[model samples]
Structures are given as C-alpha cells and as structure tokens.
Target: MTKELKESDPGSPSPNVLRIILALRKWGWGSFWSQLVLAIIASIILIATIPFVTRAAAPNPNVPIATAPSPGIGMGILFTVIGIGIVYFTAFWSFRYTKLAQKLRGANGGERPSKLQTVKLLKTGAIFSLIGMPVTLIGANAIVGALTIKSLTPQPTGGYVGVISVQPIDMFVVQASILTILAHFVSLFASLWLLNRVSDKPTN
Candidate 1:
C-alpha cells in the first residue's frame, strides 16, 4: 500500500518572508546576548573605575599625584562610557523586539509586514532611547563636576568653609535625573509591548 504525504498549506508564507523571518530570528539572539554582555562589562568597568577614582582623590604626602583634578576627569570618562553603554543596550533590545515581531508574523504564516510597520516600530523604540540619552549625559556630567568641585577646594585645615552655593548646572542635573527615571519607565513599557505582541502570535 502507498503512503499518503501531507503538504503545507498553499496560503503559507512565501519563500522570501520565510527567509527574512529566519534571518531576523537569528539576529534576535545575537542582539540580545551581545547587548546583555556589553551592559555587564560596562557595569564592571564602572565599578572597577571607582577604586581608581578614590585613590586619586586621597591625599598622600609620599606620592606625587594630582589629588584635585584627576579623580574628576577619571570619573567623568567612566560615567560617560557607562551612559553610552546603557543607551546602546537599550537600543539593541528595542531593535530585537521589532525583529522578533516580524519573525513572529512570518512564523504564523501571516503576510510579511509592510515598510510602514517596520518604520513605526523602529521610530517608537528610537524615540524612547533618544529621550534617555540627554538625561544620562547630563547626570554623568553633573556627577563628574560635583566630584571635581569637592576635590578642587578642600576645606581649610582647622577652619570651616562657608555654605556652598547651588549652581544652575546642579539644578539641571537634578532635573535630568528625574527625566531619566521617567524615560526608563517609558522605554520599559515599549519593550514589553513589542515583546508581548510577538509572543501572542500563533507560531508554527
């Protein structure tokens, strides 16, 4: 007796869509793992730099080190690198989510998404990522500046320094911190929504 073979549905995804989806799925894992690893590395670097900063700030009679200016610059570079790393990670996650959505649609045997759909996902993700960038930069600068200021003018020995004046830049930094927190929540929501949409699709 001859055996019957089952064929895939004619309405299933075309070769092009299937190929695109497979490519996107492959990229999703790469993007996620790379971003995660980079974020971890950034955190480690930032943490390790703290000791260098502290050593630079300490007063030492035996060693000839510029105790005043070095710590501030070191800290500034560290924070800036950290901020950039965070932004890059967030952007990677956003891009991954968008790709995952496309892949899900393809896997579900649905028609390939249009250019507009792709653009919309990217635009929404990018907007959130951009919003956080300035906040991160400002906070990092503020931290470096504050550290520098404290290091530069040490309190007089056996004498008290007068009340420190709050600068406009300080206020800007404070506001930026607040904004950063808000932007983080927004980005989180966007990421979750994108992920949820992808997961909800019926997969093959």
Candidate 2:
C-alpha cells in the first residue's frame, strides 16, 4: 500500500512520511505513559534530595545553620543549558529518524537496516542522554536549592551572609525545567519507536 501510494501519485506524501505517521500512531500512547512514569520517578528523586541535602548541610546540631545563596543567576543559566540540550537532542533524533526512513524507502524487499546502523543510532542517543540527563538534573537541583533558601532578609550575623531572595528571573528556570523534563521523556520514547521502525524487516 505504501509503495503503491508512492507510485500512484508523484506529488503524494513519500513512503517515509507514511512510515512516520504509522510509527506515531503506534507509539503515541506508549510515549505518554512512559513519559508520565519518568516524570513521577524524577519528582520522587527530587523530593528525596531535599532532606538529604538539608541534613548533610547541618550534620552537627551544635553549629548554627548556614544561609544558602540566591539561586537566581546560577539556576537561570543551568536551566537555559538543559533547555538547549533537550531541544538539541530532540531535533537531532527527529532529523536522524526522518533521514533513516527516507533511506529505507528505497531498500529491496525484506531488507532491514544493518545492525551496525541501528547500534550506532542507539549509541549516539545513549551518549547524549548520559551527558544531557545529568546536566539537566543538576540544573533542576539548583532550582530546588534556590527554592529552599533559609531566608532572604539581610542579617548581620555572619562573616559572609549570602542573599537568599528569589527573583522574577528564577521563574524562567522553573518554566524551563518543566518544559525540559517533558521534552526529555517524550523525545526519549519517540526515539525508541523510531529505532524500532528503522530496524524492522521490510514488508510489502
């Protein structure tokens, strides 16, 4: 049917286009559920981190509690970085999958993408996730830290009392974190589906 569609109408959408649509139709719900699971897990880890860090910072009861620094600038930068990474990775896989689909359109009957090609694509994705997930998470953590500062009010109680105030700019970090997390999981599942499609044996 896909081949017939391509042959019947020169202007019709390419076989690759149809493949993409089918892949989306098949994997869309799986993608959503997987992303939801990841988001829930990430939230749990984020929640757990707060108390651990708090306790670590004040291990001894005798010492006075130290003030944390304003997270505005640092978190804003980190968020921007992760946001860029998520976008880059998503865009990267989208382009790769589209190109692979187009390439497969010309294969002979029963042909499948070489194992090496599939492995390479998976490796590239894994490398990106390894680097990007950590960086994004660290940025999220910075936001958590920023949100949990002891006090923002000026206190003359110390040699170096840092400001703990939240600024309007910090909202960007929060927004970016939310978007990045969603994008990260959605892209992850979509990429997985694309990989499966590209690796599948061709059928008429």
Leading candidate by TM-score: 2
lDDT of each: 0.50, 0.51
Model 2 residue 59 distance off true place after TM-score fit, in angstroms: 31
User: What's model 2's TM-score?
Assistant: 0.52
RMSD in Å for candidate 2, one decimal? 10.7
Give per-residue CA lDDT, model 2, range 1-204, as digits (tens): 344435464544445545654554345444444444544444444344344344434446553334232433355344545544454645455455544544444333435455477557655654565465566767777776666653445544557665545543344445556655665656565766566665666555
Q: Report the error of model 2 at residue 112, Å.
A: 8.0
List clashing residue pairs in candidate 1.
none
Tens-digit per-residue lDDT, 1-204, candidate 1 = 001111265655544445434444544444455545544554554555555556656777664332232434554554455454555657476566545555445545566666456546545655656665665666566665764565565444426554334334333333434434343444555544444443443554
Q: After superposition, how far is residue 184 of candidate 1 from its true place, in Å?
A: 17
- Give the C-alpha miss distance for residue 16 in model 1, angstroms: 2.9
Scored against the true structure, residue 60 in model 2 reaches a CA lDDT of 64
**Quality of model 1 by C-alpha lDDT:** 0.50
Q: Which stretches of candidate 1 lie over 4 Å from their true place?
A: 1-7, 66-69, 81-85, 88-95, 98-103, 106-115, 124-204
**Every model's TM-score:** 0.45, 0.52
